[model samples]
Target chain A: MREPTVRTQKIKKDTTRTRLIFFGILALILIICSVFCEYLTPYDPYLQDLKNAKAPPSLSHLFGTDRYGRDMLSRVIVGSKASIFSTLLLVGLVTVLGTMAGVFGGWHGKRIDTVLMRISDMFLAFPGLVFAMAVAGVLGGGLQNAIIALMAISWPKYARIARSETLVQKEAPYLKAARLSGSGTLKIVFKHILPNIIGPILVTSMLDIGTMMMELAGLSFLGLGAKPPTAEWGSRMSDARSLLSSAPWVTLSPGVAIFISVMIFNLLGDTIRDYADPKSRGR
Target chain B: MDQPALKVSHLTKVFTRKGQPDFTAVDHVSFSIQAGECAGLIGESGSGKTTVVNMITRLLDPTGGSIVLNGEDITRMRGKELRKVYARMQMVFQTPAESFDPRCTLGDGIGESLRNNGRSRRETRDEVARLMEVCGLSADFASRYPHQVSGGECQRAAIARALAIKPRLLICDEATSSLDVTIQKEIIALLNKLRREKDSDLSILFICHDIALVQQFCNRVLVLYKGKIVEQGEVDAVIRNPQDPYTRRLIDSIL
Candidate 1:
């Protein structure tokens, strides 16, 4: 092994430490919002205290009362549990499903490839969110149904990316060696092909997570997602629209939550991608 | 007097381009290498020598004719039968660095054939170590990746990979063409050593455009011109007394 320079090592260590602290803070926030959200909610999120409706921020109503007099801070905090975890689930499931289909089609590269790619193209030809909405509209409102709609359209993007990457990997000379090694195509695809393309797949997965969250929130905000009276971030913001002048806190709190969460996921993705790239890591 | 190690009977390859006339890369080329003979196939860039090797190794299917190894026809073998052919014949590519799957250690890359052949980990490790040593690579080179090695070393590793299967016929597709002249001479010597160390029955189909190297290394030579064999005989006989006009042209061009 070559001797490592102290200066370069220290720089690397500092960058790692910084990323660790950043993710640590985000993780801590997530845990607190998911676990202690109800305790933090001064008022029951579902209960409508019409008598105190449209009240301004005060000790009794920390983020001020919504039109239905629910605490705005409580609603946004409570909604975080649903949005955060479901986004994780959506990202995880879609990546597995998409990467599998894409790798399979790309490796096979004939009739199977043609059929799989054509199907993805058929779906992609329609605008992504519009198709998700159409599916959600048919399934009716709820987190699960909206998720299904989003997932149906979302997996194809990964499938296309993975498929193109697999095509490039297939041409690598190692594959010819693998064939001469007496290994079959399936073995070559799984053992050799999959690992090479994993980096880009992960980068794509990270980029998708934030956008998917926004799509989910947009669905709920339009009343096509979590249904009536569910304190989803989007649903809460929808209810707060009329009271913008009186209690801007009502919509603004959830809006800011949505924006921050999306930004965090995007930044997390960008930083991780840059870390994986050698040229970027040198700095 | 001995049975041919490899026989290609009127092999042909016609590439069909859309909306254009079909292109014939190698047309009606027939030759046979007797057991223990080293033959070189020499040609210019598009003379279709690589196409011939690809057809013989089953990398590309011939539009016509048969490829027989040790009297077993494998012209149209697929799946299991094709794999069996791989055990009988292996090819070393032109560029060694590009030959390996860069993701794996040299040990893993060289040991892959044995692994596919169902050799256990201990056996594979021993075999990889031994092959690396034979290829003139140190034991440490086994654990290193392709990028960490020099071009000559990479070619040696590639040769080791081809040798792991102990195939009867080794096909060299301009295997040393990418290296400098000194390394090329060294690689040619190593290949000669491999052939001599094995049974006298071991055969090599050395493919190159380098006529001088082919004249020195190969016992017999076939001069291909425009997908057709123009002249072939004992290397000394053909070089001293060329019959075909194209063969004369090829020899005259060497400088």
Candidate 2:
């Protein structure tokens, strides 16, 4: 214990607090903006005024207007609600489904582990976005279809992660002692294994929410997501791609919104991973 | 003669490898402890002592063997049956620091066995407090997590947890090896006190490489080498005359 430098390094990393409050603040603002967009805006996000169409960033309009004369700022703020809500739902579903599958697979190895893991491997074999696009295409166009497609492809990542983590967790000394104390598989998996791996799982979920947001936006851009007049950021940006030379704010505003939101989630993930680790305290 | 508390006969474990011959970790090992007796299984690292303990505790299913605890065969027990056998016999792990869940307080860790045994929450707390005292720990320390306490205190908590359901056989798998010399002696003293309490007929399968410690603690001793029981007898007799060369070496290496 005197010269175990590796142990010291690990402890230092676990306890170190990398100032993540900045990321938290950024994420919180996005959440607040999404949740309270209706009350915070001066203009209706969907009110298309052809007379003011393609207006540049102005004092009255703020982020100017899109091709349809809808306020870009208001649209970006309001459209986020759907993306955030869907991301939360997708994340929650993925975590529950994946962890349950993984815990079961890892606990009852042999045939069960092989079967569960192989199915996930099949899901993982496809390039994630391409597989999702294919599913969405087959299911026809709509936000609901796109979400279903995204969920179908996304779950395997969590399942694989949970399974591997559970395999390691089940071997921990406490769990073995729990077994020696007459605890059943359910008790050991939930009480012992799940708590230990929850930090990593949370980190995974947070980072992936950013990915899910981007995916939802991508589907929208391709006309297979939020229908017309919806004013989603990705579709909003796509509509302005042809008018790039004239009104850049139409595309740039939504692009910036997407970038900031995604960065906030990613940073939030790093902060959580650092803070949740017993060795790492936050700055 | 009184029936033995534990009977492990022809216990064997073979580690099969991919595209290679299997490694026999333990071969035809057999031993038994009489009720209220303290039996020490002495062996060096890789000598299959831990494997034997793992099999007996049912953590690792043996390749072939029968383990009978107080007249019940637990060798092939599965699911609910195996879980039932757990309360009757418990294993104290080598590393006390790792014996408890990091998320759980010492009180929760100790009270888990009682809860499994269907003791009410209030009753479990009372029993855990009493067990903590029996293991020489203060009641207030029960609220602390494993990492919050010292190694010696954690080991005492581990002992209390093992004894929570009042198991007849306690499989101590090099339990005191991870503690400091002072703490090691303290743990040994605690076990001795438990044995002398008269009402608790606790049988211990104490696994250790420390021949001198076994001589002080165990009534009977079994020496293992390369997965075989090379020598075994009454602890005093084996120490006074270690017939096997490996046993002599083990005794000589004792610091």
Candidate 3:
């Protein structure tokens, strides 16, 4: 019985490893495409052709043409730079900022912890998108403003995770040992605290990539994110929304692009989490 | 008169809660270890042995007391000053494996203090190897993580880490209690070797509930009961003729 169980566990481990590599490659490819999208597009995304407006999918234009006569495939390939990169940037910014704030608060718990945690609580209390809209509106709507808005609302979650993890690690004897070894506060936090607490934070950030992308697109759809002529996936979809019934391809093109990329990223995040967790490796 | 290596006067720790009265864990405990002396603090669980160790290591603030390490008053030290005092004193915790950062190798943990104190990388590496060897661990054990090593080996590594900076005072808070009987004897032997070799400089404050182990390792003994020192004297004297009821009970309970 034990032998069978061990064999099954080994099989499961192999499958997860294979899946991890598969999704990792797919995500990497998506990122690579977004980076070199300019060279990859067959047609200039911005160049309009009134003659081909609202044309259905064909061999020449695989995703059809929008009302502005922009090739849907070309537009999507170009839009990825803004859509994917901005989301990645937003996630990076929040992860760093939040983890810093959390570690600081957790390390020095007193008036500072109370104040910082309360501030995070205030951000968490608000509906995330609504707060982003309000912030974006106040900052004068643009992709940059929209990113700032999302960052302001998104960082609190990472902060919460990092803060809690830091709190748990704060009581570990190793920290005291480090302190006794003449390590200063910064050294202890960076060398001992951060490395131990980073696993959960990394997983959380990886999982947040897809959610953040969708939220960024949501902001663009609401006219708070990427503006017209920017070739952003959300704004492109928003621009073609009225053509849903007559020219469904126009609206569906960006939507499908968003769907495919989100699925890849989400699956990659799940695989990474599985890979990181030792217990999940079929123990 | 020479100052003791470690001296605590009227130490106390009160745990304050939201609606309940403050509970005192260590109540006005006082003790001192002369240079080169091995002083044992024996107490049952929740009898405030850990509280005293925590207070001495400055991991917990005493409600009312002063801690003097190496004849310098470190009771009010903070930040850089407190960190500087760590060079003179160090502690080994109950759980050997948990006393080290899980992410760091044993070598890193051992060399951490040396590097922090401005030693060159090459010097740190050489010193770590020497310390590992001195603590009965081979140089190859440096690359092994705490989880990969046996309890005795990890405890030895922990000892190596504590000894890296050559602290004048070593506080062992039930360091060997977590190990099995054979391993515990081995750790006690190691501590005994260190004490004999450094008899002129290093002082040890060995904390444990095992009266037999304390008698074997410690010269002086302080028996703690309900946050108070019920009795204290030479290890042999106290063991043979206990003064307080708690002390007698403690000695009787220890087989």
Candidate 4:
């Protein structure tokens, strides 16, 4: 076996305290941004001031004003709520549906596995964005519809990963021992296989959160997500496109918000992935 | 005098990997154990020793065979019937670390077998403690998870879990191979103690690669080579006066 590296030691120490603090702070910020959206914004994001349009950054409006004189800071904060909420909802739906489908497909192999995997392959064949767009087009544009569209395209990834994990877990000696101990199918699947594979599932779900957020933003940018005045990052970017050359702050603020949010989620996901791995834990 | 503890006749297992030709893992293997007798299945890896044990425990359905345990034909059993058969037979797997749910503590893992067999939590807690003591583990260790304990302790916990339901047939599939030699001796001693104390026709199928270990523990020994039984007889007779070339080779390797 390879000796533990300094990097591994740092990760172990990092996981003990800093990781939890990071998540706590991120969650707290997002919650406060969501719950106090109105209070956090100095001006109504939709209210336009033609005279104040394209104003440079100042103490009154820290991020300055957009082409429509909408406060960039206000729009960014309010927009985060829509993106965060929709992504969280999409992830929740996918986790539940994907895990169930995976457990079933993995536990009952042969026909069930074959059919479920075929369906997953079909979904995988379509480019995720194209698939989401098609679904959104069919369902029509709205926050809820975009979430539903994202879920339809995203669940297959979880299903495939979950099924593979479950299949491997099912063959493990402990699972076989559980079966020989007279554990029923339900008990074996839920108690033995599910618990064993949960580490991977959790890590994947965390990573998927970032992907789902980006997808939601993309849909919003394409006008297939939340409608105007909804204060979503994608829609804000869409609204500011015409003023890209003039009032760049409108696009810059929400664009920066999207980037930071996605980066934070990705970082958190990577941390979780590293922590959940047994090899990494040993270090 | 009661029905033989286990009757395995013509047990054969074939594995046909995808895109590969069919191959026999256990070829027409047959054996019978009297009540309370310890039978050792000795073989090298890929010799199908574990497969036979798996088949007997109903973990793997045999391609061709009949396993009659306590006069019940478990070979044809399915679902509920198989589960009922399982209640009477338990297995201690190799790699005790992998034998447990890492998320659960040792007590939980042991208690799980009892729970599966319909033992209540209140009833099982005391029994679990008692079983842990019988397996030479302290009751306090029950609170620790598998990872928190040594490999030997984990194996003991596994043995205790196997014995939880008071199984008629206990299959140890290289159960002690992953442990140190001293720990292996201790585990072997524990098995012998449990066998004598239970005195309830508790048959054991001790599977391992070490012929010497089996000779010390089991009454009867079956030597397997390449999925076929090359030699088998009373432990002393086979160990002292070998029969097949393969058996002699194995003995030579061990000595």
User: Which candidate number maximizes DockQ?
Assistant: 3
The weakest ten consecutive residues by lDDT in model 2 chain B span: B191-200
TM-score-wise, the better of 2 and 3 is 3
lDDT of 4 by residue, B165-249 (tens): 8898899999989999999989999998998897857999889998889988999999888888888899999988998998888
Place model 2 in a CAPRI quality band. medium
Per-residue lDDT over B184-239 for candidate 2, one digit per residue giving the tens place of the 0 to 100 score: 99999998888898444889999998888898999999999999999999998888
Candidate 1, pairs of clashing residues: none
Best by lDDT: 3
TM-score of chain B of each: 0.98, 0.97, 0.98, 0.96
Compared with the true structure, what per-residue lDDT tens digits does model 3 show for residues B1-255? 398888899999999999999999999998899999999999889999998998888888889988988778999889899988888888888999998899999899999989989999999999999988888998999898888999899999989888888999999999999999999999999988887888678899999988898998899999999899999999999989999998888878864
The residue ranges of model 4 lying beyond 4 angstroms of the native Cα positions read A1-16, A36-75, A277-282, B230-232, B239-245, B248-255
User: DockQ, in order, for the candidates?
Assistant: 0.52, 0.65, 0.85, 0.58
In the range A181-259, model 4's lDDT, one tens digit per residue, is: 7888988878777888778888889888888888899999999999987889988889789988877777888888888
* B1-255 per-residue lDDT for model 1 (tens digits): 467999998999999988999999998999999888899999899999989998998878899989999999999899987887898788888888988877888899899889988899999999999998898989999899988999999999999999998988999999999999999988988998998899685799999998898899999999999999888999989988899998888888884
Alpha carbon lDDT at B119, candidate 4: 83
Q: In model 4, what lDDT does residue B224 have?
A: 87
Off by over 4 Å in 2: A1-18, A277-283, B198-200, B252-255
Reference-based lDDT, residue A175, model 2: 88
Give the distance in Å from residue B122's predicted Cα in candidate 1 to where it truly belongs.
2.0
Alpha-carbon lDDT of model 1: 0.86
Poorest stretch of ten by lDDT in candidate 1 chain B? B246-255
| Clash number by candidate, in order | 0, 10, 0, 1
Q: What is the interface RMSD of candidate 4, in Å?
A: 1.3
